[model samples]
Target: MTSEPVTLHLTVGLPGSGKTTLARDLATRTGALRLTPDEWMQPLFGVSDVDGKRDVLEGRLIWTGFRALRGGLSVILDFGCWSPEERWAIRDLAGLAGADFRLHHLWVDEEVRRARCDARWLEVPHETFPMSAADQDRYLAACIPPSADELAYAPIPDPPAGHETWAAWAAWRWPSLPRLDLS
Candidate 1:
């Protein structure tokens, strides 16, 4: 087996799709580093004020992930990378590090996601709280969620054949790495 254990695993989904929770759980189970956009943004610009800070932090996180992969450490990136360009960037990063890259796209009903976001307002830190009604409406209008068709027909490498859950496939394919828990 190769001494290098690096692999880049990215979780893409809409807000409140359990990306952060899953990423954290995965990090704890595996020895992989977890990077969440919310965690990075909240400290610097606050969640409500992430418009300008997001661009900077996204670059920073991707760069940091690349560095970690070079050091033979796997990384889990929790971000809503709905854009095709963003996904491509991750694919390129994995190639640069010579590490296997896995993409776990979280799929949830729109109503379910919104309800979860509503409930999370009381659970998360004030700085990372959900947007106000007007703000949320505007944000939703401005940003479009990826459609099922988009995910099902992504250009990147498909998840291993016949494997439904990412955790199962990871454990089977990468026995050296601990199983990730998204639930």
Candidate 2:
């Protein structure tokens, strides 16, 4: 019997870049499970990134996404995913889960991003954490846009040095994620 293909949709962007809006839309259209760390962080701990908690939460959410993929379900991870290494690792994880990977990169003018962040904070103070001007500037400077090859879904490159596999690297990167068994 032919089985349906599973997919992992990853959203990449700085805060206020409309990643969540796109993720929500994709989830509704595709019936994919949407996982957004911000939505959990606020209610769970009342703050974001306290003592590296966000990393822990993201690790668990990724594991959940992996399980859903293995069950032939699609997943959307609405993470800013600013770094290239993080994106690569997530793509590798999707491959391990036998799922196709798609990366969505959203971009907006700095002024517009700032304004959006301001509006979001004002409108839903409880739902979103406030983003300071310095935080926005730092995040924008640090964001690494996906290259053409990456967006094309090219074959994944080897894991970074010292890591035997992408799973190993992911375990190290997100300490909360257990080393996935390849068997």
Candidate 3:
């Protein structure tokens, strides 16, 4: 008998909100292929220095996600899908796959986010930085919160009983991956 296909769960959150960290933890647990926007963009075109290139990178990520879904791979997309339009785009892609798609919004307070940013700035490799402070400020400022109407589309609630935290779910899903102390 054919095994059941894996489900895709897209994790969305702003920078410094622990989206990537959570995604990594989830990936390790579930053995799902995690796709971070930065993973695809930085190496190909360098740091997003221009608006045009940033748009191009986003498009490429969307396309790559579509292809991966079609291939029946459970993907965890780690990106700041701050707007309803962007979330809708992801929803449409999930629909096309006929796979269950769940969104996990990494909710964190602004103070926590900024503190994480300051503390982890050096954690990002040199290849990803060197942009001016002005550029970083502009990017942060442009990150608008989701509207009430937009949030109505597909709100990400907490995981169900079998899958609670990343480690809990990961242990249940893929037993082969290395287990981390999430406690």
Candidate 4:
């Protein structure tokens, strides 16, 4: 058995619940690859989130993360996986790869979360997101905290076979040169 050190770290909580901060810290300490959709959102589309593409982009990241784990590299995804289904899928993936999985749920008071969100810009100007009360409300309403056992996770529909698609590790193959037939 390979004694490779591989871990899958997932953040679970609301936006302002310090997921990113914790993710950053954990990644730094553990030398894990931190994947944050929010960090990519602003630069990619000039907005925090774009219609139709956010989920697709996140899915791609998850695929890449599994690839990393397969290589025995630790991965930290700071996507605030709020649903049991989401968390369960990740946990199952890690188990399949024989990697340690951890779910860090940032429990913060509502008032404190709001304050943190409000102070983000001033506190961390370089990495500020435009968060509104409406956004917070929407996220809270949609969030499904993991319950006891099951990692606060529930069964989610598994992706179809061959669902995890990725580029060949060799990167790409060049087309064979066509032979010139001089008759």
Q: Give the candidate number with the greatest lDDT.
A: 2
Give the alpha carbon lDDT tens digit for every residue of 1-183 in model 4. 223379899998987899998988988788888999888877778666667566767777776777788787899988887766567666766666677888888879988998888898678655657778898889889998777765644443453344331122101110121111112
Candidate 3 runs further than 4 Å off: 1-5, 127-141, 144-183
lDDT of 1 by residue, 1-183 (tens): 223357788887777788888888778777788887677677767664444556666666766777788788999888767665456546645766777777777767767877788888777675356656676566456555555554454554444567554434434433333333334
Model 2 per-residue lDDT tens digits across residues 70-155: 99899999998988789999999998898989899998988998899999989987778888878877887898999888888888
Candidate 2: which stretches are off by over 4 Å? 1-4, 181-183
Lowest summed lDDT window (length 10), candidate 1: 173-182
Give the lDDT of residue 119 in candidate 3. 62
Candidates in order have lDDT scores of: 0.66, 0.89, 0.61, 0.71
Candidate 2 positional error at 72, Å: 1.4
Residue pairs of candidate 1 with colliding backbone atoms: none
Give residue 12's lDDT in candidate 3 (0 to 100): 68
The TM-score measured for candidate 1 stands at: 0.71
Query: Candidate 1: which stretches are off by over 4 Å?
Result: 1-5, 48-51, 133-183
Clashing pairs in 4: 146-152, 147-152
